[model samples]
Target: MYTSDPTPTSTLLDAAQTAARLPYPLLVSELALVLADPAVQVPPRLVQPLPGGARLLIMPALDANTAITKLITFTPANAARGLATIHGDVVVFDVATGQRKLILDGPTVTARRTAAVSLLAAQRLAPNTRGPLLIVGAGVQGKAHLDAFAEGLSIKEVVIASRSAASAHALVTHAQSLGLQARVVTNADEALAGCPLVVTCTPASGVVLSTLPRSDAFIAAVGAFTPQMVELGPELCRYVADNGTLVVDTVDAEHEAGDLLQAGLDVTRLASLADVIRADAFVVNGPVLFKSCGWAGWDLAAARTALAVLPH
Candidate 1:
């Protein structure tokens, strides 16, 4: 029974406040329901190249009562110039009534949902995870992950690593400012050395962390969604398929995941987080990895959470 206004109502601060209030377990359960619900259909993203270090990605999600469309633009050029790398808006419409209910700030929504996705995945996938938590990439996603994860788990140590040592140092400073045990590391090897759970938020187009020093750890690769971007190499996929569980947001998306596809990896058993959450898990004796290409269901879940917390 909602109608679209002449002007969209949601703002960044509004979304942020809502995001902060949405409990981690609630977000996780909502995402699980969205994925497992047969009425929801979220297809693979359709991406388009753009000019000046920008790319356009379109994502669509469907449920029994609603349809969501998101158009996102990534412009590293803009980011370098102190602009948001991602900028866009989200449209939510009632499937039954065909009434557009709301339009929201896409960047804030994306950041919150994506971080929530990572934390949820880590909660389900990683075990005995006391840290020395290592985070690769200190970009927006990386920062968001740290912020969200801190809200959900107890962290004793945090190692921030990036290609730019300065960026790593900055993140270390930020973490310390928040009273976290944190420091900067050099590269993947150093970051993965003793960390029990590592999250990569880099936007590398090729393999960033291929193989780890040991199999006693956990990883959540949060970057890379296209047919050419991957934060880890094929070794990680092979390891996951052989010794651990490899749950993806979607199978079709992983098939197009540049690292796995290029490495001739056949990820035949791609289970959604919903499936994993609902099913009984097997005991694992080695490192477990979860890869995410980002999913539209997460956006809808985050949007709903934002709506619940924003002032009416």
Candidate 2:
């Protein structure tokens, strides 16, 4: 059977082009559908250690009609070298004919999809949707999350904090460019109580969020994926588990989620993003903490959406 192809020549989309194809709203829609699809298969990601404290990641996922693999290298030291920390490409293929269909910039897909996942969790779990959103970490993921919340949630105000003044102000400028009232704070913890919707995207080796959020707060901790890295304080994580709902993006998080793992949380007992979405009746009691570990299924879903936006 001939497969319908979106990129006959395997057209390669750069960062900007790929970002253009997968807007937050479209990516969120696709994520909700793909996450609930029983036919989708996401294999565990392979993390191989490279020399000099670098890592090579191999992620693959597929569905009835499409297949994708994202190969990327992660080096924490890249920051010291004044270079990007993550770099790679997402290659898309057709299932029926086993032919290459398209290629997308890997880092773009990673940043956008990661932020989109957090946005999805916020949409379902956040107690307050209106007012100022607090964002920690002023990197690529921080920018992507800002755009997602601003565009998808129609959030009109933002407060940003980062280790670097230049980076934080730059993100503040970006937020205002989107017509959102934006400012910078010196401390994320100090800014937490005022903003009920919060996203932590730092790559901290220790707990970045120690303060307990307000009862109406919704927190998406997307910073630390490895057991060696953690962004949520142990006490705060335990508080959420006892007093509120603790959610994860995928089951893989049980082993990979540094925030929950370091927080001494029972990762296996917590509900997931899919679980909340499928629940017939859901109610929020206290703060909601959504921990996200990387998953290839998200990349596969993003590939489908990115391809659909491409001309046949």
Q: Per model, state how many residue pairs clash.
A: 0, 0
lDDT, candidate 1, at 203: 67
Count of clashing pairs, candidate 1: 0
Write candidate 1's Cα lDDT for 1-312 as tens digits.
Answer: 112234434343445555564556677667766766777788777778998656898988877766788888987676457666788877777666666766766877787778788787777777746776888888778777787777667776788888767778888888887789998877676567788878888866556787653566777777877767777877777777677666665666555566566657665556666666677873555777777777787877765554455454
Writing each residue's lDDT as its tens digit, candidate 2 over 48-153 gives: 9899878899999999888999999988777667677889999999887888887989999999999999999888888888858999898888999998998778
* Model 1 ranges off by over 4 Å: 1-25, 282-285, 310-312
Clashing pairs in 1: none
Stretches of candidate 2 exceeding 4 Å from the true structure? 1-3
lDDT of 2 at 136: 89
C-alpha lDDT of residue 292 in model 2: 90
